[model samples]
Target: MSKILIVEDEDAIRRVLKKVLSEENEKFVIDEAADGVDAVAKIKINNYDLVICDIKMPKKDGIEVLNFIKKFNQEINVIMISGHGDLKTAVEAMRTGAFDYIEKPPDLNNLLTSVRGALKAKVVKSGIKKNKSSTKKGKYEIVGESKKISDLKDLIVKIAPTNAKVLILGPNGSGKELVARQIHLNSLRSDGPFIEVNCAAIPSELIESELFGHLKGSFTSAHKDRTGKFEAANNGTLFLDEIGDMSLSAQSKVLRAIQENKIQKVGSEKDIYVDTRVIAATNKNVKKLIESNIFREDLYHRISVIELNVPKLDDRKEDIPDLISFFINLISAQYDKKNITINEKAIKKLSSFDWPGNVRELRNVVERLLILTESDQITDKDIVKFSGK
Candidate 1:
């Protein structure tokens, strides 16, 4: 059922509108608000598919309400209503992002048709939201039962709901990116975009434009206006991987964006405000960088409000057995091969080695064993040949 809110100060018109909307379809669950203030309060508490707001009302007007909806809930369709047929106000309403405009005494047929059309749009938005939620499930799984892994999972659950800036710390190939992604998956902005930028991968000269964007023809190589990661991640999560590798100049700009929630394009002075939840990961020792005057101390403090350290595979050896089995099934499915069994001795031998490269290295070794082994099962001999002990 789609919920609709009717914002009108007049009780009689409100009742008639409700009657007309109720007669349209049984799926329409309607609510009435006597004024704009009441409408906004209801909007804050409940999710409405469409709002029928009066252009002129007490305490607040339709334009004010429309702007508020655009700011917070862009998905909701709004239909502006008024007794006085003012073309200017109707045009203003449409320009301000109203779905449609209907002058009162609303033609029953016209109103019904408009309402149905607006409701169709609502259905489409809901379907997109549903598909996004489905995609988010099982997208990033932190596989392990060790105390270290469990503690990290607990911390993620506690902090994901809030818009806290997270700093993930770990060695190279220690699954820091995985931890950052998991945090994004569980966050309030899960339905929004997840923008990832690899600081170390991009050249220092182009990193500024890569992050803050630039206007076309503003620079020598500029051909098209580009939207940066921050704008791309507006109302979503931005994962800055290998953040310690970001240039000091870029770090200062990033610090400003974090402080003000606004960023300027590389070629433009106009500030663009973005509601991006930043989750930065770094394998490099940022404190040492700070002491060396390469990384800004203030920027470091800004991004590390919630620090999470991923445990190295050597430190969490209890998880090796589970990791091996996970990779076996995962790799087997990917390669269209039936998963083979690994004997106890093989497991023991694999777990005994010091994995300097962490979980990432273990996954690679498991896949190598699956592909290189001749028998139906991975045995102690396979481990002796493939496990670089």
Candidate 2:
């Protein structure tokens, strides 16, 4: 979740911006300030991910507020709101470290774009910091020996060496990401980066700009030339998750890119060639989506060069013991605890239930057992207490 601050003296503009931004993303927690002084007082108290400030206010101006935030917490991004005559001051504020500035009667698209970009930048920075302290973990393993899983492993080894556009079908939390990572690691492009995009998470209006790069002046808030995922994942594997939810407009452009091995930026006519391998995944049935006219048939055929269906946990219940053992050790180490052994009766109890949420939910239950259970060994009573029953 992202916390945002809107600092504008005008009640009408502040209320409108707050309403629109709240509607844009439900995860946003928004706060409003009537003046720069009030904004500074709140900034000192709450840790905001982004701030939208007005330049000309009755009290302290936007530049002062930006300076205060930069001095207080340089990581918090600020987007200045400038009037027609305040463009020069806005530019100065940018030089001082504002993320971007919007003119009065702000373009809805530009404001939203700037806000999204700022939040995304903060998240990337935080992730990088976390990764720096993390241990060098080994490759992601599909932790099951069921016949279905074994067959999937054999198929992955055969297809990974080739640059085939593979489509993976599975229910949510059935390890679709794990499968994609395994393929990328075994593929010829293992030396390159593995980029993953959740199609359902990005809004339809910004999908094009997110995939294909945009020029500095392409949109009202395109402050600088940006590299999109296609360019970022060049000579690597681009994993598009939840592809069935992508808008048809973006789907056509993606189809063009796959067909020609080239993609034009959002506002450019010239094409940029890329040697990218695309792997797509979706939980929905594409054939049904096509019949409903929600998904493009040509795009579906193009991406589904080799379709791999991952079985849900219910179908592979035979592997529950191995999966339980794997998660016990994996999650226990994260909490700095010794590996807690599970009794045979507890394992049997876990295996008997139907897991609609699949491996993801099971892992959560294991973690809960590790933390909440009193005994070193996980027994039937432990399973009953914290195994998500």
Candidate 3:
């Protein structure tokens, strides 16, 4: 049911409008405001789908009420009730954010039609807002029972709802990008696009064009119009992986983009607006980079609203069992084999060694074990031979 507020000083007209609205739609929950002051108070305190206010009121006029409501809550749909002689005010009210206008001696069909149309518009607007918010959320799913993994998951849940920029720090195979994805998935903009750019992978010369885009014929190889990552991720997220390796010049542009929420294409004179949530990840110590004068201090601050440190494989050895099991299942399905079980001795042997490449390395070992082990049940000797334990 949609909530609606009716604001009019006269009790007779207020009651008549309420009755007409109620009679027209049984689903509408109608509330009455004696004057503009009361209407503004109700609008602030309650969530109303629509507000219908008379042009002239005791404390404040309909125009004031309309302007106030729009400034406070742009989502609320409003309809202005004006006297026959107040047609000019009614039109002005529409320009001031009123959904529609109706003459004071209200026509039933006109009032009903306007109310229905306003409600429909409100619904459509609300859907767009919801979708925009969803796009900013990232997608990351890491299942584990280890305390470190569990704590990371808890942290992500707490931080994802906010608009804070995050910097994920971890080793190359420690799933830093996964954590970044999880943060985006949980954020308000999850429904928006999740654009990933590997800074280290892009060539230094082309990094600017890749990130901020460029106009056609701006450069020798420029063949067509292109939108940059920032533009593509408008109202969404931009994940910068291996940020520590980004070139100094690119760092300057990135810093500007983060600070201004705007980007200028490499060859274009025009600046494009972007509402993007930034999630940066790096395997190297950004602090060390800053000390070495490789990373920009200003850019680091711009992206690090919150920092998440992903634990390495050796740091969380207790998780080996679960990780091993997960990989076994994953590889078993890929190799078209029945779910295989590993012996306790084999798990112990696997857990005893230091995983230099972290979870990714462990997964490869599991796949190797699956391929080499002749029996359905993997033994310690098989793990030792295949994993080179």
Best by lDDT, which number? 2
- The sequence of per-residue lDDT tens digits that candidate 2 reaches over residues 1-389 is 89999999999999989989989998899999999999999999999999999999978989999999989987788888988788568656765667667778886765775677678657744554322123121558887878999888877765564455789999998999998888887655778889999999999988888898899999998999898888889878999999999999999999988755678898899888776779999999999999999999989867876788999999999999999999988888888877578999999999998999999988888889899989789999988878768
Off by over 4 Å in 2: 1-137
Candidate with more favorable, higher lDDT: 1 or 3: 1
Between candidates 1 and 2, which one is better according to TM-score? Answer: 1
Worst 10 residues of 3 by lDDT: 130-139
Candidate 3 regions with alpha-carbon error over 4 angstroms: 1-140
On residues 141-240, what C-alpha lDDT tens digit does candidate 3 reach at each position?
Answer: 5747578877777677655644456789889799888887877775556678989999989999999999999999999999998889988988678999
TM-score of each: 0.66, 0.65, 0.65
Native-to-model Cα distance after best TM-score fit, residue 89 in candidate 2, in Å: 62
Report how far off residue 321 is in candidate 3 (Å): 0.5
Judged by whole-model lDDT over C-alpha atoms, candidate 1 comes out at 0.82
lDDT of each: 0.82, 0.84, 0.81
Which of 1 and 3 is ahead in TM-score?
Answer: 1
**Model 3 RMSD to the real structure?**
13.2
Ordered from best to worst lDDT, the candidate numbers read: 2, 1, 3
Clash counts for the predictions, in order: 0, 0, 15
